[model samples]
Structures are given as structure tokens and as C-alpha cells.
Target: MKVKKQKRHRKSLTFYTACFGFRKPYKVLCDGTFVHHLVVNRITPADTALANILSATVKLYTTRCVLVELKRLGKSYSEAL
Candidate 1:
């Protein structure tokens, strides 16, 4: 039997839309150098609810799952960076 050698790349690329994203409620970022949970708290019928969804988008973070390492923020969620 013969064994094959594994290959590795020096760099890789990914898009934020590929991971977590939304057209409304929120946009989840999964960047290695810069990542954050972006959301807009919109008031619903009687209370606030996440209008847009981004569950699968967050899946982009494999070994470095950003969701698991998320920290509750105190700044304005609507702030544009």
C-alpha cells in the first residue's frame, strides 16, 4: 500500500456573507483578525425580536468558532464601524 502526503496552504480566504449574515436583524462576523456579533435590536409586536437570522452563516467558524467565544457587548449595537 502507498501513503499520500497531506497538503497545506500558506493562506486562506473567506467571506463574511459565507458565514453568519442577515439582511435585517443581525450580521455575524467570523473574521480571524477582526470578528464581532453585529445586531440591530428591533422592537416587535410588544417586545424586541431578532428580525433577520444568521445561524448557518456563523458555521464558518470551524475550529475557531466565533459564536462560542462571543462576549456580551455594552456599546450601541447599531453603531456602524
Candidate 2:
């Protein structure tokens, strides 16, 4: 039973991830999503339109999203990864 539950959880993770981020060597996209639902006191960037676009197009992510964003902007977060 434990093994079956583990498998089901793993499968759910796979499906959830596929529905969320897109993967690349350098970065991933949030797509504004699940973790966002959990965040409090989050700030948009200085530019509202860019923030809006990101909010619109990006789905769900965690701090992992910030790591990917850093990488996309040619910043580093390998240690975080």
C-alpha cells in the first residue's frame, strides 16, 4: 500500500509539473500558479505592465521559480538548484 501511494504521488508530481513549468537548461517558467496562491506580501516589479504580463502568462511556481528567473536573466542560482 505504501509503495502504491508513493507511485501515485510521484505520478501526480509528474503531471502537476508538466501542467506547470516549461524546462530548459537555463530556466523554467511559472506560467502565475499554485505557490502564488500561497504567497503573501509579494511585490510586483517596478514596471506594472511587465509584472502584469508575467502574472498573466506565468502559471504556478515556488522559490524555484525565482531561481529559474535568475538563470534566465543570466544571473546564477546553481547552488539553489
Candidate 3:
């Protein structure tokens, strides 16, 4: 199952690189929900986790609005902030 998933990811990434010209050290945008999911699931070292999935290094970014929303959610999500 994992091998199949990896192959699928590789094919998709190839398409992106060929058609969309995406480069390595992929940039990933996180929303409040995604951040909360990561925190709740204990997916620490987010860059590494993302890199493993993409089979390349990654740079994580989140919008100011996302941060504000996470903050608004208050203490339970403080670790995400």
C-alpha cells in the first residue's frame, strides 16, 4: 500500500515539474485546520514530515490570516501558533 502511494505521489510530482515547473525544496502553505491537525496528531517536525511525503526538502508557510484564526481559537491551539 505504501509503495503504491509513493509511486502515485512520484507520478503527480513529475507532472507538476514537467507542466507547472515546480522546483525542489517545495513550498507548502498551511491553513489553520492543517496546523491544528498536525498538532493534534503529534506530527512534529512538520518540514521533515512534508519532505518525506514529497520525496524532497520542503519550506513551510502559513498566512497571517491563518495565524490569526489559530490564535483566536485560543489555548488549545496555542501550540500550533
Write down the lDDT of every candidate, Cα atoms only.
0.28, 0.40, 0.85
Per-residue lDDT over 4-71 for candidate 1, one digit per residue giving the tens place of the 0 to 100 score: 21111101112433554423323433442333333442323111112222221222222334333333
The runs of at least 3 residues in candidate 3 whose Cα sits more than 4 Å from the true structure, single-residue gaps closed, are: 75-78
Looking at candidate 3, the ten consecutive residues that score lowest on lDDT are: 72-81
TM-scores, all models, native as reference = 0.17, 0.26, 0.88
Predicted structure with the largest TM-score when compared to the true one: 3
Per-residue error (Å), model 3, residue 42: 1.1
Candidate 2 lDDT at 35 equals: 22
| Model 1: lDDT to the true structure | 0.28
Spell out the clash pairs found in candidate 2: 30-59, 31-58, 31-59, 32-58, 32-59, 33-59, 33-60
Clashes of 3: 0
Tens-digit lDDT track for model 3 on 1-81? 399999999999999999999999799998888888988898878888888989999998888888788888886665653
Q: Which segments of model 1 are wrong by more than 4 Å?
A: 1-22, 35-81
Clashing pairs in 3: none
Ranking by TM-score: 3, 2, 1
Q: Model 1 compared with the native: what TM-score?
A: 0.17
User: Total clashes, candidate 1?
Assistant: 4
